[model samples]
Target: MSVDLQTVKRVARLARIAVSEEDAERMTGELNAILGFVEQLNEVDVSGVEPMTSVTPMEMKKRQDIVTDGNKAADIVANAPATEENFFLVPKVVE
Candidate 1:
């Protein structure tokens, strides 16, 4: 697919970019080059190829989902400047 000057201008307008006429022309060429490279990528053979998350093969680790207290209440409250009844104290905003 080719990007024309009008298409480039429309794209610039949608992106809220301040594109001059000369800059739009330059952008048209750059966009066309990127599309051409993507077209070239489409020509590659990928028959029977598995999709990969990375270049190297790796097994995703699994863990059981269970809820438990982190057991650091005292440590967490230690950094608070004002705490009362095992909870952080904040200034009252309403009567």
Candidate 2:
């Protein structure tokens, strides 16, 4: 789609930007050029191209999902002033 001075000014107003008539007029051409490039890109055929994460291929780093320092429920609640069933008790603030 093409951009006009009114569209530029409206966008600036919605973004809370104070744009003058000169700036809006300038931005109208700039926005239209950018949209023209995007429209051109839509004409390219990419149906057979696969999605890629990077230009250079490399395996993603991973870590083992083994549990460590677990089964310490009682030890965790030992320092709390109030705890029940390994859960901290707090005063009810809502009614």
Candidate 3:
């Protein structure tokens, strides 16, 4: 419900931020204010609100989910030193 100087210093130390005593004192009030605003938000009635991906009403753009050979298999293997069936041929390194 509130932030104190010690909590601010501990948080700063954990975050690896260099904060002087004065800055820590200042952040104490700022953090408390932010937390207070968040607490206020918790009191709002939202049981009727539906979960949505966006604020504006719009349908999600979709495409057909289908599998197809990209058709560029031949083009992709064109520059290979050796290829078979549109696949790269590599030398077998293992005996």
Candidate 4:
């Protein structure tokens, strides 16, 4: 797809980027080149190719599903200026 100066300016404004006329012109050519490359890729035949996550085959490492706190309540409460019943004590703000 061909990108014109007005389209480049609009895209820059939407992205909240300040682009001068020269930079916008340059960007227009760069964007068009990227689109041309994508168009070329669309012409390739991939009828028998399988989708893959990685180039080489390898199993993903995974840990057992478990949920537990680190058991550092006492250590954490020790750092608080005021704590009671294993919880931080803060001043009441709502009432």
Candidate 5:
């Protein structure tokens, strides 16, 4: 897949990037080179290779799922500017 000057110009327009004719010409070559490299990579055979998230092997740190806070309703409601019966009251915006 080769990138042409028009394709580069269209890509720049889609990305909302300002590209001069000279810059567009440069980008056309750069994009074509990247596509050529990707085409080369497509020729490699990796049928049995397994997908991995990282190169190094390590176990993730685990933590016990437990609720630490128990019944702090009064403490939370105290900080509210307008609170009524363990609930924060706000101005009614919708009619």
Candidate 6:
């Protein structure tokens, strides 16, 4: 999968990035290099290798799944700029 200048320009446009003609050419080369590296990686064999989140094997910490408000309603309301009867007051848009 070789990338050309036009392809690079299209990719830049799709990603909402502004690229000059010279920069587009450079980016095209870089993209081709990355794709070449990916192709090289694809040639390697990994039949029995297990997928891992980290290189070092370690158990993830577990916690109880409890849902609560933590009893801080007054403190939360004190920080609000405008509150009315336990609710934040905002400008009504719809009639």
The local distance difference test score of each candidate is: 0.89, 0.90, 0.91, 0.91, 0.91, 0.86
Mind giving the per-residue lDDT tens digits that candidate 5 earns over 1-95? 79889999999999999999999999999898889878987777889988788788988888789987779899989989999999999999899
RMSD of each: 10.3, 11.4, 11.8, 9.7, 10.2, 7.4
Backbone collision count in every prediction? 0, 0, 0, 0, 0, 0
**Candidate 3 residue 84 C-alpha distance from true site, Å:** 43
Runs of candidate 2 with Cα error greater than 4 angstroms are 44-95
| Model 2 agreement with the true structure over 13-95: per-residue lDDT tens digits | 99999999999988899899889888987788999999887888888888888776679999999999999999999999899
TM-score of each: 0.45, 0.45, 0.45, 0.44, 0.46, 0.45
TM-score of 5: 0.46
By summed lDDT, the worst window of 10 consecutive residues in model 4 runs over 63-72
Query: Is candidate 2 or 5 superior in TM-score?
Result: 5
lDDT of 2: 0.90
lDDT of model 1 at position 74 = 81
Q: Where does model 6 exceed 4 Å of error?
A: 44-95
Candidate 4 local lDDT, 5-63, one digit each (tens): 99999999999999999999999999999988788866789999987889888889888
Q: Give the number of colliding residue pairs in candidate 5.
A: 0
Which parts of model 3 are misplaced by more than 4 Å? Answer: 44-95
Q: How accurate is candidate 6 locally (lDDT)?
A: 0.86
Model 6, TM vs. native: 0.45
- Comparison by lDDT, 1 against 5, better one: 5
lDDT of 5 at 35: 90
Number of the predicted model whose TM-score against the real structure is largest: 5
